[model samples]
Target: EYWWWSLFIVLAGIVLAVVDTLTGTMGMFGDSGLLGGLFELGVIVPSLALGVRRLHDINRTGWWLLLVFGFFPIAAIGGGILLVSFFLLDNFLILTVLGFAMVIGGGILGLIGIIVLIVWAIKQGDTGPNKYGPDPRMATSQ
Candidate 1:
């Protein structure tokens, strides 16, 4: 598929992220913070769409994109929350075990999700037509 476009989109996201960071550091973007949010949204939307489309090219559903990026953050956050709960609660063994379990489970899922995305990102597109549709590479060449 359009690997180049995917690469470009990733780079654009990074560049935009850096710009947003700089803007936040300098406090120059705006007062409402809408611009900064827009900058963030700019990256999120394109990255998700690109990932999903690329997955489609490889005969995978767009949901895989959500699975990859979405699961990690959710897991990490859940882990963090559990970790915080461990500290706040008066109980020791029970809370600690539960908290650590959530944290570890979330971490593992996060890692797996990352690995899946990486595999998807680097792996070549389908050789010919796939469940998603006709091969973009083939169509373009023809």
Candidate 2:
């Protein structure tokens, strides 16, 4: 159930984003466009709630979602900083090496975290609940 919901939400968001991009509207909400912004605004809370619930279903804390989502942004920001450093500190071989290491390492770790989250999302919830509340499956069964 959680997997299905997550998949649906992702697909819907993708569709909206694609539509927004293709339309090329000078939307008040910037590049996302009107529909995209509205869709994002409407779904953000529910999506986060669903993500948290899905994590809970796997006997994990909601904070795992933050870790999972944080990876990509942190990686991108680190990469951007490295790109700037490459320009400003061209003479420093060590900075370039460290920058490459951080970008690559962060990207790899982010990909691993995403894969782990997907695996957890597909797995069955803990039977009779280990933590975070009663088993959603059992709750529905009764």
Candidate 3:
């Protein structure tokens, strides 16, 4: 139930994004100036709602999504450190090499972070229930 709704919302958001990208009118109700704000409303809100369901399914606070997303910057910092170390070594060719490497490394870390969020979402919650509320999985049985 929740999973289906979440999927629907995500797909809808994606569709809206594509349409907005192509038409530049943001769903026939927005202009370029408003696209950014409209995108947030049309996409981010429902996505967050789905995220809430995802967290609910896992017996976690949806607030943790922020933490999970925040991992990207932390990962980028680690990459930045590696980049600085390479730069400090005074190898110009390798310095440039490290820059691209850090970009890819950061991208990989961001991907992994998103994957972790998805995995966290699908993981079965407590057998019955925990702090979040009644088990979404068990709501059907009861």
Best-fitting candidate, scored by TM-score: 2
Q: What is the lDDT of residue 139 in candidate 2?
A: 43
By TM-score, how accurate is candidate 2? 0.75
- Cα lDDT tens digits, model 3, 16-47, are 66766776665355442245446556767777
For candidate 2, the C-alpha RMSD (Å) to the true structure equals 3.3
Model 1: per-residue Cα lDDT over 113-136, one tens digit each:
878877877888889888888887
Window of ten residues with lowest summed lDDT in model 2 = 25-34
Winner on TM-score between 1 and 2 is 2
The CA lDDT at 56 in model 1 is 83
lDDT of 1 at 44: 71
Q: Count the backbone clashes (under 3 Å) in each candidate.
A: 0, 0, 0
Clashing pairs in 3: none
110: Cα error in model 1, Å: 1.6
Stretches of candidate 1 off by over 4 Å are 1-37, 140-142
Expressed as tens digits, the lDDT of each residue in 1-142 for candidate 2 is 6667767877876787777778775365875677778877997888789888888987889898788777778677777767777777763677666667777777898889889988888887788867788887774653
TM-score of each: 0.67, 0.75, 0.52
